[model samples]
Target: MFLPNPDAEFTGSYERCGLTLKEYQELIKLSLDSRTFLVKQSKQSAFAKLDLYGFKDEMVFLSGSSDNIELLHEIMADYGEDVNQWYQPFTSRIRHIRAMKSQSQYHTQTQTDVFEIA
Candidate 1:
Protein backbone atom coordinates (compact mmCIF):
# COMPACT_ATOMS: atom_id res chain seq x y z
CA MET A 1 0.00 0.00 0.00
CA PHE A 2 1.32 3.46 -0.96
CA LEU A 3 0.20 7.04 -0.65
CA PRO A 4 1.47 9.75 -2.99
CA ASN A 5 2.76 13.21 -2.13
CA PRO A 6 0.41 16.14 -1.82
CA ASP A 7 -0.36 17.55 -5.28
CA ALA A 8 -0.07 21.25 -4.66
CA GLU A 9 1.58 23.64 -7.08
CA PHE A 10 4.83 24.86 -5.50
CA THR A 11 5.62 28.50 -6.07
CA GLY A 12 8.92 28.69 -4.18
CA SER A 13 12.36 27.97 -5.53
CA TYR A 14 13.83 24.52 -5.00
CA GLU A 15 15.57 25.83 -1.88
CA ARG A 16 12.21 26.45 -0.28
CA CYS A 17 9.86 23.71 -1.39
CA GLY A 18 9.39 22.54 -4.98
CA LEU A 19 7.96 23.21 -8.36
CA THR A 20 5.07 21.23 -9.78
CA LEU A 21 5.83 17.54 -10.11
CA LYS A 22 5.68 17.79 -13.90
CA GLU A 23 8.24 20.59 -13.99
CA TYR A 24 10.51 18.81 -11.55
CA GLN A 25 10.27 15.65 -13.59
CA GLU A 26 11.25 17.56 -16.70
CA LEU A 27 14.28 19.06 -14.98
CA ILE A 28 15.34 15.64 -13.74
CA LYS A 29 14.97 14.20 -17.21
CA LEU A 30 17.09 16.98 -18.63
CA SER A 31 19.74 16.38 -16.00
CA LEU A 32 19.78 12.69 -16.82
CA ASP A 33 20.06 13.43 -20.53
CA SER A 34 23.01 15.70 -19.88
CA ARG A 35 24.56 13.00 -17.70
CA THR A 36 24.23 10.52 -20.53
CA PHE A 37 25.88 12.94 -22.93
CA LEU A 38 28.67 13.54 -20.46
CA VAL A 39 29.37 9.83 -20.08
CA LYS A 40 29.52 9.37 -23.83
CA GLN A 41 31.47 12.53 -24.56
CA SER A 42 34.06 11.86 -21.88
CA LYS A 43 34.45 8.26 -23.00
CA GLN A 44 34.01 7.25 -19.40
CA SER A 45 31.98 4.65 -17.65
CA ALA A 46 28.72 5.95 -16.21
CA PHE A 47 30.30 5.39 -12.82
CA ALA A 48 33.60 6.97 -13.76
CA LYS A 49 32.66 10.48 -12.77
CA LEU A 50 31.75 9.21 -9.34
CA ASP A 51 35.36 8.23 -8.83
CA LEU A 52 36.24 11.79 -9.74
CA TYR A 53 34.44 15.07 -9.18
CA GLY A 54 33.24 15.80 -12.67
CA PHE A 55 29.63 16.49 -11.78
CA LYS A 56 30.36 17.39 -8.18
CA ASP A 57 28.84 20.81 -8.44
CA GLU A 58 25.59 19.56 -9.85
CA MET A 59 25.40 16.75 -7.35
CA VAL A 60 26.01 19.07 -4.45
CA PHE A 61 23.45 21.52 -5.73
CA LEU A 62 20.86 18.82 -6.16
CA SER A 63 21.59 17.46 -2.72
CA GLY A 64 20.91 20.89 -1.30
CA SER A 65 17.41 21.15 -2.72
CA SER A 66 14.22 20.33 -0.81
CA ASP A 67 12.42 19.82 -4.10
CA ASN A 68 15.01 17.35 -5.33
CA ILE A 69 14.71 15.44 -2.09
CA GLU A 70 10.96 15.05 -2.31
CA LEU A 71 11.02 14.43 -6.04
CA LEU A 72 13.64 11.70 -5.69
CA HIS A 73 11.69 9.94 -2.97
CA GLU A 74 8.54 10.16 -5.06
CA ILE A 75 10.35 8.81 -8.08
CA MET A 76 11.84 5.94 -6.12
CA ALA A 77 8.43 4.95 -4.90
CA ASP A 78 6.50 5.34 -8.14
CA TYR A 79 9.14 4.52 -10.76
CA GLY A 80 12.07 2.62 -9.38
CA GLU A 81 13.28 1.49 -12.78
CA ASP A 82 14.52 5.03 -13.25
CA VAL A 83 16.46 5.08 -9.98
CA ASN A 84 20.03 5.34 -11.20
CA GLN A 85 19.73 8.94 -12.31
CA TRP A 86 18.18 9.83 -9.00
CA TYR A 87 21.60 9.42 -7.41
CA GLN A 88 22.33 13.10 -7.90
CA PRO A 89 20.67 13.89 -4.59
CA PHE A 90 22.52 11.18 -2.69
CA THR A 91 25.96 10.91 -1.20
CA SER A 92 28.79 9.59 -3.38
CA ARG A 93 28.81 6.21 -1.69
CA ILE A 94 25.07 5.83 -2.03
CA ARG A 95 25.40 6.95 -5.62
CA HIS A 96 28.02 4.27 -6.25
CA ILE A 97 25.86 1.53 -4.78
CA ARG A 98 22.85 2.54 -6.88
CA ALA A 99 24.93 2.88 -10.04
CA MET A 100 26.56 -0.52 -9.55
CA LYS A 101 23.33 -2.25 -8.75
CA SER A 102 21.64 -0.59 -11.72
CA GLN A 103 24.07 -2.33 -14.06
CA SER A 104 23.59 -5.98 -14.88
CA GLN A 105 27.21 -6.73 -14.07
CA TYR A 106 29.12 -5.32 -11.15
CA HIS A 107 32.69 -4.02 -11.37
CA THR A 108 35.10 -4.31 -8.46
CA GLN A 109 36.95 -1.06 -9.12
CA THR A 110 33.82 0.97 -8.70
CA GLN A 111 34.04 0.30 -4.99
CA THR A 112 37.18 2.41 -4.62
CA ASP A 113 35.29 5.64 -4.99
CA VAL A 114 33.23 5.59 -1.81
CA PHE A 115 32.94 9.24 -0.84
CA GLU A 116 31.78 9.76 2.72
CA ILE A 117 30.98 13.26 3.89
CA ALA A 118 33.27 12.97 6.89
Candidate 2:
Protein backbone atom coordinates (compact mmCIF):
# COMPACT_ATOMS: atom_id res chain seq x y z
CA MET A 1 0.00 0.00 0.00
CA PHE A 2 1.29 3.40 -1.01
CA LEU A 3 -0.14 6.44 0.71
CA PRO A 4 0.75 9.67 -1.02
CA ASN A 5 0.23 12.84 0.91
CA PRO A 6 2.30 14.93 -1.56
CA ASP A 7 3.20 16.87 1.55
CA ALA A 8 3.96 13.99 3.83
CA GLU A 9 7.52 14.21 5.08
CA PHE A 10 8.00 10.59 6.09
CA THR A 11 4.73 9.52 7.53
CA GLY A 12 1.44 11.38 7.45
CA SER A 13 2.47 14.15 9.82
CA TYR A 14 5.13 16.75 8.91
CA GLU A 15 3.57 18.98 11.54
CA ARG A 16 5.13 16.72 14.15
CA CYS A 17 8.44 18.25 13.10
CA GLY A 18 6.94 21.61 12.27
CA LEU A 19 7.16 21.06 8.54
CA THR A 20 5.05 20.03 5.62
CA LEU A 21 5.94 17.56 2.87
CA LYS A 22 5.58 20.24 0.21
CA GLU A 23 7.86 22.50 2.20
CA TYR A 24 10.43 19.78 2.47
CA GLN A 25 10.31 19.20 -1.27
CA GLU A 26 10.64 22.90 -1.89
CA LEU A 27 13.63 23.09 0.40
CA ILE A 28 15.33 20.20 -1.33
CA LYS A 29 14.67 21.74 -4.74
CA LEU A 30 16.00 25.09 -3.58
CA SER A 31 19.17 23.51 -2.26
CA LEU A 32 19.77 21.62 -5.47
CA ASP A 33 19.11 24.72 -7.57
CA SER A 34 21.47 26.72 -5.43
CA ARG A 35 24.23 24.17 -5.86
CA THR A 36 23.65 23.89 -9.58
CA PHE A 37 23.65 27.64 -10.03
CA LEU A 38 26.85 28.02 -8.11
CA VAL A 39 28.59 25.38 -10.15
CA LYS A 40 27.49 27.06 -13.36
CA GLN A 41 28.75 30.41 -12.18
CA SER A 42 32.04 28.92 -11.12
CA LYS A 43 32.54 27.28 -14.46
CA GLN A 44 31.66 30.47 -16.26
CA SER A 45 34.17 32.35 -14.16
CA ALA A 46 36.86 29.80 -14.85
CA PHE A 47 36.18 29.90 -18.54
CA ALA A 48 36.35 33.67 -18.56
CA LYS A 49 39.88 33.47 -17.21
CA LEU A 50 41.00 30.95 -19.76
CA ASP A 51 42.20 33.63 -22.16
CA LEU A 52 44.40 35.16 -19.51
CA TYR A 53 46.23 31.91 -18.87
CA GLY A 54 46.59 31.07 -22.54
CA PHE A 55 46.45 27.52 -23.88
CA LYS A 56 50.07 27.11 -24.86
CA ASP A 57 52.40 24.80 -22.96
CA GLU A 58 51.37 26.07 -19.56
CA MET A 59 50.57 23.31 -17.08
CA VAL A 60 47.41 23.55 -14.97
CA PHE A 61 46.52 21.64 -11.82
CA LEU A 62 43.20 20.47 -10.45
CA SER A 63 42.22 18.79 -7.18
CA GLY A 64 38.93 17.06 -6.50
CA SER A 65 37.04 13.80 -6.64
CA SER A 66 37.66 11.67 -9.72
CA ASP A 67 34.21 12.55 -10.97
CA ASN A 68 34.80 16.26 -10.48
CA ILE A 69 38.25 16.03 -12.04
CA GLU A 70 36.81 14.25 -15.02
CA LEU A 71 34.10 16.82 -15.36
CA LEU A 72 36.64 19.58 -15.00
CA HIS A 73 38.78 18.01 -17.65
CA GLU A 74 35.84 17.95 -19.97
CA ILE A 75 34.97 21.53 -19.16
CA MET A 76 38.50 22.74 -19.77
CA ALA A 77 38.79 20.74 -22.91
CA ASP A 78 35.57 21.86 -24.49
CA TYR A 79 35.16 25.35 -23.07
CA GLY A 80 38.51 26.17 -21.49
CA GLU A 81 40.07 26.34 -24.99
CA ASP A 82 42.74 23.88 -23.96
CA VAL A 83 42.81 20.12 -23.90
CA ASN A 84 46.25 19.52 -22.35
CA GLN A 85 45.25 20.89 -18.96
CA TRP A 86 46.23 18.28 -16.38
CA TYR A 87 44.01 17.28 -13.51
CA GLN A 88 46.93 16.52 -11.20
CA PRO A 89 46.27 19.48 -8.92
CA PHE A 90 42.77 18.32 -8.23
CA THR A 91 44.06 14.85 -7.47
CA SER A 92 47.03 16.11 -5.50
CA ARG A 93 44.88 18.26 -3.24
CA ILE A 94 43.07 15.14 -2.09
CA ARG A 95 46.29 13.46 -1.01
CA HIS A 96 46.96 13.25 2.73
CA ILE A 97 48.79 16.13 4.35
CA ARG A 98 51.89 14.05 5.03
CA ALA A 99 51.91 12.73 1.49
CA MET A 100 51.69 16.22 0.05
CA LYS A 101 54.22 17.65 2.46
CA SER A 102 57.25 16.84 0.34
CA GLN A 103 55.49 17.29 -2.97
CA SER A 104 54.02 20.62 -2.02
CA GLN A 105 57.05 22.74 -2.93
CA TYR A 106 57.83 20.94 -6.16
CA HIS A 107 54.19 20.50 -7.09
CA THR A 108 53.32 24.14 -6.69
CA GLN A 109 56.28 25.13 -8.78
CA THR A 110 55.40 22.72 -11.56
CA GLN A 111 51.64 22.95 -11.40
CA THR A 112 49.35 25.71 -12.57
CA ASP A 113 50.81 29.05 -13.56
CA VAL A 114 47.53 30.91 -13.16
CA PHE A 115 44.46 29.47 -11.51
CA GLU A 116 41.55 30.26 -9.25
CA ILE A 117 40.90 28.79 -5.82
CA ALA A 118 37.27 28.23 -6.58
* CA-lDDT, candidates in order: 0.43, 0.41
Predicted model with the maximum TM-score: 1
Off-target runs (Cα >4 Å) in candidate 1 are 1-53, 56-62, 81-118
lDDT of 2 by residue, 1-118 (tens): 1122333354555435444444445433433223221112221311111222443222323224465556566655655644444344433433443367768888977887777898
Q: How far is candidate 1 from the true structure (C-alpha RMSD, Å)?
A: 21.5
* TM-score of each model, paired residue for residue: 0.21, 0.20
Candidate 2 to truth, TM? 0.20
Local distance difference test, candidate 2 = 0.41
* lDDT per residue (tens digit) for residues 1-118 in model 1: 0112234223564214423445434334443323322122222222222233576546645465675566557656654645465454345545665577777354653556758897
Candidate 1 at 51: error in angstroms? 11
lDDT of 1: 0.43
- Report how far residue 104 has shifted in candidate 1, in Å: 38
- Which portions of model 2 show Cα errors greater than 4 Å? 1-8, 12-14, 32-118
Cα RMSDs of all predictions? Answer: 21.5, 18.6
